[model samples]
Target: MIFTLRPYQQEAVDATLSHFRRHRTPAVIVLPTGAGKSLVIAELARVARGRVLVLAHVKELVAQNHAKYCALGLEADIFAAGLKRKESQGKVVFGSVQSVARNLDAFQEEFSLLIVDECHRIGDDEDSQYQQILTHLSKVNPHLRLLGLTATPFRLGKGWIYQFHYHGMVRGNDNALFRDCIYELPLRYMIKHGYLTPPERLDMPVVQYDFSRLQAQSNGLFSEADLNRELKKQQRITPHIISQIMEFAQTRKGVMIFAATVEHAKEIVGLLPADDAALITGDTPGPERDALIDNFKAQRFRYLVNVSVLTTGFDAPHVDLIAILRPTESVSLYQQIVGRGLRLAPGKTDC
Candidate 1:
């Protein structure tokens, strides 16, 4: 299969390569949800005719990248569990961050390039898996070049991707993970250009619980336990949200509900007709989760509810309504949750 690139995607590829050639340092590329980043990554691997490791946090993304590489007629091997064993001699390897983080030295040869998908997950903390793995890899090969791709390159408590130093303190806090953003394709621009569906956002007034007393985490977000406790106090909120979803989804084909907890998701499913809805969470068994996702994609159900899952790598293009029952302070999470409905499906004018 021949891979074709749109003008913007080509620009992204060129800009990333050009930045690498000029600076010889790590770089990041920001592209909207529906902008086809896999094609760009395929082209980069095709051009960089050396050992390249594509890293993603989730298994779905690892599999997705390998599929695109195969579609592009590129020889790539998967290094993640449930995919393939670690291929020491393969030039291109698609890897899950969790799977390969411990075995950086397993590869016989030094990788010339490291491409990180969903790279914004790299936290400011030095003890993070990403930082630890990259630090070890750098010790092995000092001249390695890195390319990071993400739609949102900023973290909640941590600053932007290319941020160098904080406002007041300049001596110690020089935390610029990626040197520069080589290219960016904004979601608004993609919507304007008809590449993505514009989100029709609606606000539902829910009873606000006083969470002011809840202890804030170091990341400036409330702890999950506290948030869940606060959310559980408002008994009317879940019913109201369920009613709103039922009302709005009456005219839509598929609705994705992001719940705060597994209990909340089960409650949502309890409200809907048993056969019309399903629930999935991180704790769900692998086979059950896959089946639920497949059934949802097959349109066997009108509503799919998930907690702390399906926000990043799950893709259901026909989802016309995204009901965010989980309130989040992270902008990346908010965008990712809404992005589920941003894919341009037939007759989907707005999400």
Candidate 2:
């Protein structure tokens, strides 16, 4: 191995191997953000017999995981369209779900083990890309062992990702993708052990938007339209929030602002220094988005205001301050957002 696995990370891999030895059912390994899940995935793939396939929701993660696996002096293929590479015939393949779902015939029963990074994105929808690929691949390879790694194990509306959690007895979901959480590394444990930066919540903002009147859908999240309407009713709320964020960011190295919407992100960017801040929404073009993210990591900018894009699969260890201007009732979503700043970096004390 090129890099030594941390104690908890090796434990996670051991738990996974043990689970597969005892049962054929799918299992999950819950590791918080910045806990080096990619390394664990690499080690697991390295040890697994037969071909392996690693799935990620976005191209960023597809590339990230592929790089980690390669760092072991091992060979693997990448099958993500966004990265403009699609080589499926290899001992190990890292692929984006969209590209793989569209071309399942190339992979047909070839893999013995499948690893999904950020598996919580696999929803209950049977027709979803992830489900479609899983159904097709499992049909061809009945002995295929499935493993998932995620920071947040629960979905916003759908409770848990697995039928059982090792942490404790939890509510069950028959439709959950994985059968059990074979292992988990707690956020508090990582913080106490100095593996991650501790998160400290700031005082309540002087101005707060009233979301009480908004009703949640069956999915347990307010509709985007409703959130925008409610936010509009709060007079000068965005301005006040941005002002407070700027005040707090003065002492931080890197600041990330989670905006409620695209327009909201733009407004926040407008309030920040034009040269020191950048906005990234789902609509940003691919090349421009990549450049913006690269610049932010290089410290060319101080504040990065994004809308629902940087929650997962983004790595910038220098980020120490995270301003959540968006309101969410989902614990999983909130945790994923805050986890962005919890990575350890030089000269960084806490998030």
Backbone clashes, each candidate: 0, 0
lDDT of 2 by residue, 288-307 (tens): 99999999999999999999
| Candidate 2: regions farther than 4 A off | 167-170
- Looking at model 1, which ten-residue stretch has the lowest summed lDDT? 164-173
Clash pairs of candidate 1? none
* Error at 80, model 1, angstroms: 0.6
Model 1, runs deviating above 4 Å: 82-84, 164-173, 205-216
Model 2 TM-score on a 0 to 1 scale: 0.96
lDDT of 1 at 192: 88
TM-scores of the models, in the order given: 0.92, 0.96
